[model samples]
Target chain A: MEKQVILDPQQFDLTVTRLCHELLEQHADFSNSVLIGLQPRGIHLVSRMLDKLQEILPTPPICGNLDITFHRDDFRRREIPLIPSVTNIDFSIENKKVILVDDVLYTGRTIRSGLDALLTFGRPIQVQLLVLIDRRFKRDLPIQADYIGKSVDTLNHERVKVSWKNIDGEDRVELYIKQTHE
Target chain B: MSSLSVDHLLGIRNLSVDDIERIFQTAQSFKEVINRPIKKVPSLRDITLANVFFENSTRTRLSFELAAKRLSADVINFTASNSSVKKGETLIDTVNNIIAMKVDMVVLRHASPGAASFLSKHTKAKIINAGDGTHEHPTQALLDAFSLREKLGELNGKRIAIIGDILHSRVALSNIYCLQKLGAEVLVCGPSSLIPKGIDSLGVKVSHDLTETLLWCDAANFLRIQLERQDSPFFPSLRDYALQFGLTSEIMESLNKSIIVMHPGPINRGVEISSSVADSSDSIILDQVENGVAIRMAVIYLLAAQIER
Candidate 1:
């Protein structure tokens, strides 16, 4: 029943600037690297990062969006009519260093699905995961993010919500207790 | 409608309009999956599907088998041509034996009607009726309707004339139910004898004139004359039938406006529809075949997902 703000708009902007500098330090040219945003939610983060990466570098890299809806492990656990989002990766991801961007890292199942979904485009030379809010030690799969904005330890019942300025009129991260039927 | 209550896709009638939409919505996902470079997913890796076909088929069996494989399920193909069914085993025993092997689902095509509906009562595995005797080809109807919606958006109030052997078509029967459910005006056009009695009672208009019907429709789905399934003469001859009802270029061109052409193939090219019209731009006949895999995948994925609940 309680909610707490973790990162406000100013802190989030500074975090993005640091991440951009770290990314520029490693992959200076941004030629062989490509960024992919996991669909339905990661799209917002991908757009922000792509914009930020362009500002931080001379050349912005190729970016695409992927939907891992069909690749999910729990399709059978849910009801019928699981609506699929659009996957709009026009160019090939072949042999590129792929960076998967997402809003949160929870069970790592979404990242697993995203990895599987990425294989469809072509086998990438290397794949890395990036999350704005990494919920540490909460993985059902053995996936760990290579680049994390902030690592926060939390209870299984708590939810991490990432909001964007374009979407929720503010850039912020919050923690809340996920409500379930009693 | 929330989830498919029936456990098996025995017929389109078993699904509500909402269920059909859900299936299409799910199919949209699989359609995207196949377009990917790997074209496979591990969602059904733990699930095994036994395609127990009791009749000769090419497209339907291949499509379902591909669908299962694409979903990363183990596929065990049991055709009547090479099965114990040829050695005097009953349908129930053969399928139950497969299910006993821990097969999670069965995609069936039987010569007898209600084979899937019958088998679902005995087996713990989920069932998907690929096709049954003049009964229903649920996936075909689903793909056909899906292809239609994909080609021309919003099926509500769209006119679709299903032209050809209605009396012998499981496709026609299923399409009528499916199309009508989506709020499309359906017209069944064929030879008088080929038209089943009291078909209009299903709330579809009946027409013997193909041109008249084609002109009235935004989409015309041509059913191949089911020569293989015919026991006795329903019409006088193929030539006479083609003369009266064949969809030629002239007939098609006369309509002035483009109508979406569809066929549940193995098309009798010059009989029901001319070769020209079959290969026409507006024809989504091949798209239906490609969409068949995605539709079957959606059907299996949804059915297998709901076995426990």
Candidate 2:
């Protein structure tokens, strides 16, 4: 099985830096903005982006980690699922602009559920979606990322894995395509 | 359209007053079931309930496990130390694996708020949150409410003081919701730091003085201080905490004669509450523990019956 490398560690960092600058330029007032990272890989990416954003912006946005594992749409069928990280939003999101961060965007089911879970905490002024990699697939919901790092066209059988130095000991994106048996 | 299936018993905050009252009424039926000679029922026959405990919780976990078994359900015990959860399996993945075995329910306990709520969304099996961090213990609240109902016959206009580590105690939060919904005047008394901010917004009064709260309430629900607090900055010193907020025998004597004492044990004998008060005639601590089984049985039975019907 041949593994294709998409984004190297340095390349991923540059893309995140560019995204942070773009976010600051558009928003103008970054004080009220908050970055919410989806559990597992998204959380690591968000932390890295937050570090970059802190250096660029006047007042760094409030960043929190969220785990939507329990909020998934297809819960009944799956075996014992891994308990995701804690959902820690100390400050209220009532009127603040929230940018949800995720590692890879696949079916967009996670993002949909992430939005649903966000609503339970409080109503936000606006919610912008950000993904490290956007593998354009048939999305069941009308949801799109506000900022996307890399767009890769792939078959339904392909799987993308995002590994970070902070979490997975290595930083790279790998694509695993299912093989056909003759 | 029917309501969203309450797949998990997270807390009373989301539940309407009617829904809470209905659960209490159902619990009353199970209370009768508990009084029987067999003290067991076949309501949950052949059902499997997994007790996934990620934290050290003995009473709540045991009561829940017993409740499920009393209903004739098979109980599987999994602790954080022994389970594959220690080997990097995510909480959801572990739960998903268990659910694949066709388990009917998951009674979870984690040392983080909203843990059970998070689990409920990931699994199709009904979730009974045994205790989730300092957020809520719905069944404990249900049983506390049931015990109160059994004692007073009515909760409306009754004054109840919840003393001790309110910030870290999910029991206090659940009791506040249950007591307030049942028309009881809830007062939370503890150290300034241990008292969570905005708790007054829950329609309960907050006080730092324990004696004042004791005099004003008909019942005092004392919460146990987690041993882990010894290292935390929540309190200045254990001796100071005991002097300021602890429920001593002398303090219990000063309270109104009709006032009852309640504690969600395992009691810290000399701390938070003294031995005399814990063993006092007015103390309902044992009753709370016993009622825990019946109340949990009621919750499982009610939730399961809802699915069947």
TM-score of chain A of 1: 0.93
Q: Model 2 off-target regions past 4 Å?
A: A1-182, B1-5, B229-231
- How displaced is residue B8 in candidate 1, in Å? 1.0
Compute the lDDT of residue B132 as modeled in candidate 2: 84
Give candidate 1 regions above 4 Å deviation: A54-60, A73-83, A137-142, A177-182
Question: What does candidate 2's lDDT look like per residue over B92-185, in tens digits?
Answer: 9999999999888888898888988998887888888888887888888878877887788899999989988888888898898889888999
Highest TM-score scorer: 1
lDDT of each: 0.86, 0.79
Please provide, for model 1 over B191-257, each residue's C-alpha lDDT reduced to its tens digit, 9 standing for 90 to 100.
8899999998999999988778987999988888988889899999999999999889898778888
Best by DockQ: 1
Q: Ignoring the other chain, what TM-score does chain B have in each prediction?
A: 0.97, 0.94
DockQ scores for all predicted structures: 0.52, 0.01
Candidate 2 docking: what grade?
A: incorrect
